[model samples]
Target: MRRAPRRRGPLSTVVGIVLLALMLFPVYWMVNASLQPTGNTLRGGWFPLRPDLGGYATALRDQGRNLVTSLVVALGSVLLSLALAAPAAYALARFRLRGTDLVLLGILITQTVPGIVVANALYGAYADLGLLNSCLGLILADSTAGVPFAIVLLHTSMRSIPGEIVEAAQLDGAGRLRVLRSVVLPLSRNALITAAVFTFLFTWGDLLFALTLTTTGTVRPVTLGVYQYIGAHTNQWNAVMATTVLAAVPAAVLLVVAQRFVTTAATDGALR
Candidate 1:
């Protein structure tokens, strides 16, 4: 016998379509605006009738340095945050240390504070240490903001691993590091990739700390670089739109590449 087909309600279909359009419309507009002629962006005309690459070309040329800086800071932040957070996560996941829950809560609580408040103190500290306007300083600052979340996410993923696996590895006379390297690390790849992607995105899009910490275009990220188009006397909408679109490409690519891992990581983390 043939099964009956399921039917979606009118309101449900309408709401789904509306949500999809709402999400996609901005992306479509960004691409449309990026391809539009420089002068027509502010005219509020329909979507570009004759699109061109002139805006993209100008943005690439003007913001190339900033893009490079952003890439460096973001990549550096991801690497450092993951490196620092991973071992801590592993410990929390595998060990039964006293007050571990309290420690995790403390780390999570740090996220509640505004970045600006921390930035004030960080800026002064960076200046005192002669680290202002430096890529290393920015990398450190961005990593600090990202590490807590990475640790929490990674801990949850690690905790999902079966305790028996660790016991088996231990029975084989494996050392702590060996057991972690062979057992825990392999199982936690998805979580690591997710954490790295999230950290990269956060650092790449960070503006407040980037602006407050870095003084030179050589060190400032793409997010801060886009602001150059807005001067006291003039604003360049075409360039700004083009740059914003370009800035989003890396994040989009990262998500695409890590798409499978992200779902696994989130599920494992949430369930644990």
Candidate 2:
């Protein structure tokens, strides 16, 4: 005879739903607040029964250029971080060089150093070199966050590649660079995507470097622009909240678009 199917506990399901709601409440509040009529946020109702979009219009008008600036900086940082970190990670994974562990430990140590310290030191050098107020300067500074984390991720993924596979490629007359380009990178696609996604997010949401590295309006990113909005237009809470919502869109869209690659990384046989 067939057995009855086991049922999940209703209590557990309800508790899970409650936790999910709690996690998502802030986002709901932001959307709710964004839709309220101007100057009504202080007494806005819980639901947006009558939504207004003037706040979004104002946000786009005011923050659009900064949004573009953020995209440029974030994309540049992702490229720079991956270009530098990928090769370093590959070397660390494949080579048996002396002090490889020490090198990696140093990278980890850099992560612990405060961003303010790095920015302070860089300010003097940038002034001398004239990198201040430039897109290139912001990109380089933002990569300080991306490079080390990406290196750690890519190194772990590359290390998990079967030694026999790499040896077989070498025995087949493929050079190290060719093998890495064709075999290692192809196999590590998920890891690369993971690194790229995170690097983009890190650079996109960065406010510290944008604030520290730039002084003029020419290169302001959305984070800094939002900060300025807060200071200059404190009464415009609806617009401010709308800008905050808009700033989150790219991150949300990226996670959705890259969900497959993320799942592959999580479940792939290599790390298992």
Question: Which numbered prediction scores highest in TM-score against the true structure?
Answer: 2
lDDT scores of the candidates, listed in order = 0.86, 0.92
- Tens digits of per-residue lDDT, candidate 2, 196-233, equal 99999999999888899999999999999999999988
Those runs of model 1 whose alpha carbons end farther than 4 Å from true positions after fitting are 1-6, 232-235
lDDT (Cα, tens digit) per residue for candidate 1, span 126-183: 9999989999999999988889989998898888889999999999999889988888
Q: Top model by lDDT, which number?
A: 2
- Give candidate 2 misplaced runs (Cα > 4 Å): 1-8, 267-272
Error of 1 at 37 (Å): 1.5
The 10 consecutive residues of candidate 1 with the worst lDDT sum are 228-237
Evaluate candidate 2 by giving its C-alpha RMSD to the native, one decimal.
2.7
